[model samples]
Target: MQAILQSSDTELDIVRALRENCERPFEDAHAMPPAVYTSEAFLALERRDVFRTEWLCVGRASALANCGDYLSAQIDDQPVFVLRDASGALRAFSNVCLHRMSVLLEGRGNVRRIVCPYHAWNYTLDGSLAAAPLMDRQPGFCKEQYKLPAVRCETWQGWIYVTLNEHAPAVESHLSELSKLIEPYGMGDYVETFHEEHVWDTNWKILAENFMESYHLPMLHRATVGPHSRLEEMECPPGSPAFNYHWITKEASLPIGNAHPTNTRLEGHWRRTTALLAIYPTHLVTLTPGYFWYLILQPQGVGRVHIRFGGGLAPEFVDDPQAAGYMATLKTLLDEVNAEDRRGVEAVFRGVHAPLAKPGHLSPLERPNYDFARYLAGRLGAT
Candidate 1:
C-alpha cells in the first residue's frame, strides 16, 4: 500500500510540475519533468485519453492510389489498416480476424482481398467476410453479420489519419488553420518516394521533443546540419490548439533543402525557409520548398518508441530529370540527421532515469517544446 501511494504521489508531483512549467512565461519556461517520461501509469492514462481518442496519422494518402492498396499499423495496442476500397474510397477497419481474432495484414501492399492465414477465413476488398471454410457445421452462422468493424478514417491535406474513437473531431477542421498557413508549399501535392519504420530506445515524447526544437543543432548535429543553423534567425511562435510550429531560414547546404531551380511557387526567402510542424499527439513534419519528411510516433511501453518514418519530393521536383539524384541526396541527409537525433534522444532518456536528473530551463529556440509540454499536460488532465 505504501509503495503504490508513493508512486501515485510521485506521478501527481510530476503532473503539477508540468502544469507549472506550462504556466511560466517563455523567458522562464522549463523542460518536462523526467518522471513524465518514465511512469507506466501515466502512459496508460495517455493511451486511453490521448492515443485512443486522437486522430492518429497512418501515412500519406498517395501511398494507396490503387483500388486495393492497403497499409497496416498498430495504434498503441489496437491493430488497424487503411486501404482504398473497390469504390476508390479511402477506408480503415479493425485488422482482426473475427474467427480466432488474428491480425489480418502485416505491412504495406496491394491485395485483391484480406485473408486470415490461420483458418483461411477470407474477406473481400471492402472487408466483408467472403468465406468461412469448414464452418458449415456451425449453427446459426451468418457471414453477412460478420463484416470487419469499420474505423473512422479521414484525409487532411494529403495524409491519412485513423482514430479508434468515432466522435473525435474531423482532422481537416482541426488542422485547417495549419493548412492555410502552409498552403503556398502545396504539401498536398508532394509525392512520397521512400518510407521505412524503426524502433528507437527512447520514450516517444523524447524523440518528439527533439524534433520540436533546434536548440541542440549546433552542438549535437554539428557534423551535419549544425553549421548552417543560425539560432538568432529561427522563429518560434505560439502554437495553435492542435499544433505547434517553428521556422528556420537558411542557405541550405543540401540542394534539395532549398527550392529547386525550376521552382516558382515560392519567391524570395521562402526558397530557403524550412517549416518544422509538430502536430498534436505525435506527428512531426520537416517541410522545405524542395522536399518534406515526417515522423509518426507511438510509444512501445514506457521505454521505447515505434516510429513510422518517410519523406518525399515536392511536386515541382517529382518528375524532373534530377529527381532520382535529389531523392538519393535527401535520403542520405535524412539518415545522417536521424542518426544524430537517435543518439541525442536516447542519451536524454538515459539521463532521465538518473536519481538527480530533473527538468531544466528551456532556451528561446525551444518554444515548441514548451508548447508541446502544455499539450501533453492538458491531454493528461494535468492542466
Candidate 2:
C-alpha cells in the first residue's frame, strides 16, 4: 500500500481494540473504536480485505442498456471502467492504458472505442487493443498481448457488480437469500430514473452505519423523514454471511408514491414496510413498496467517501402518465433527506478525531450497526 494510505501506531491499537470487541457477544458489543474512522493504516487494510475483495456494486445494468455505454470509477483506488460491448455483454477492465498507464476514459458516456489521450493508443469496447500508432515498428511487440486486463464482473437483479478478486463468490450466490427476501419487490425490473455522485467529507463506514439503522432518523432527519419514522416498529434480524437487513413499517405517503399498484401481492405489514440492506462491504439499499434507492460507497481515504446515489420507481409508477413529474418531486424530497444525512454524519466524522473519542454502547435499534462491526472485524482478520 502507498505510504499516504498506511496506518499509524494509534491506528494499529484501534484495530487491536476492534479484535477484542469482536470476541464479545452481540448484546455486549460496543460501537467500533473511533480510530477506525480516521486511521490511514486501517483504511489501507480495509481496502485490501474488504473493498478490493468484495463484490462491490458499481451501478445498474439498465444504465448501460445500449451497446457501447460505459462508466468509470476507482474501485479501491484502482481506476476501472464497466461497459457494454457490441454483442450486448457487460464487461469491466482496468481503465489504465496498457502502453503508458494513462486512464483511458472519464465519467460515463457512449463510445465506440476507448482512446488514450496521452499517447493516442486505442482499445475496442471489449478492451482489446485496437490501434497503437507506430507500434508496428517496434520489433517483437505483439498487439494481441497488450489488451487491457479484465476485472471480474457480474449482475444480480439489474445491478452491476465488479470484484478485483478472482476468487470472490459470484454476486448471485452471495445475495441468494437476499434475492428471495426481496423477490416481491421486483427489483430486477425497477427502472433507474436518476443518479448523482458526491464526495462526502465523512468516513465510508460512518456513512454506511448511519444508513443501516434508522435510530438517528428521529433526530438527524427530524425535518424530513424523521416525522414519519416508526422507530418502535423497527426490527433488525441477524445478518447472513453475505448481507444484513432491517425492517421498518410505516403508513404510505405521496410524492414518493405509496403501495405500488402491481405490488398488491405483498401482505399485511409487508405492504407498509421497507427493507434496508447492507450487502457486506459497501452496497446499501432500501427496498420499499413503491420505489428503491441505493448508495454505492467507495472509500477515498480514512475521512472521505465517494457515493453513487440512485433510485427508481416500480413498474406501476413507471407506467403512470405523470411519472416524470412524480419522479421530480421525489428527487427533490430525497435530495433534502440526503443533505440532512451528510450534515449529521460529517459532524460525527469530526468528533471521531477527538483524543477522548471512545466507543459507546449501542441501542437495540442499532442491531444492524452491531452486525456491521462484526463484518468489518472478520474482514480485517480480527479474532
Q: Among these predicted structures, which one has the highest lDDT?
A: 1
- C-alpha RMSD in Å of predicted model 2 compared with the true structure: 2.5
Model 1 TM-score, 2 decimals: 0.96
Using alpha carbons, what is the TM-score of model 2? 0.94
RMSD of each: 1.7, 2.5
Q: Across residues 79-167, which tens digit of lDDT does each residue of candidate 1 receive? A: 99989999999999899999999999999998898999899899998789999997878888988889998989999879999898777
Q: For residue 153, what is the lDDT in candidate 2?
A: 90
Q: Distance from true position, residue 377, model 2, in Å?
A: 0.7
Q: Worst lDDT window (10 residues) for model 2?
A: 1-10
Tens-digit lDDT string for candidate 2 (1-383): 55433445555677789888877878888888887898777887787778778888999888999999999987887899999999999999999999878988998899998999899999998788999999999998899987888999999999999988888778898899999998877788878888889999999999999998889999999998888887788888888878889987777666344566556656777777788989878889988777889999988778889999999887778887876887788788889999999999999999999999888788888888888887887777432
Q: Where does the lowest 10-residue lDDT sum fall in candidate 1?
A: 374-383
Kindly report which residue pairs in candidate 1 clash with one another: none
Give per-model TM-scores. Answer: 0.96, 0.94
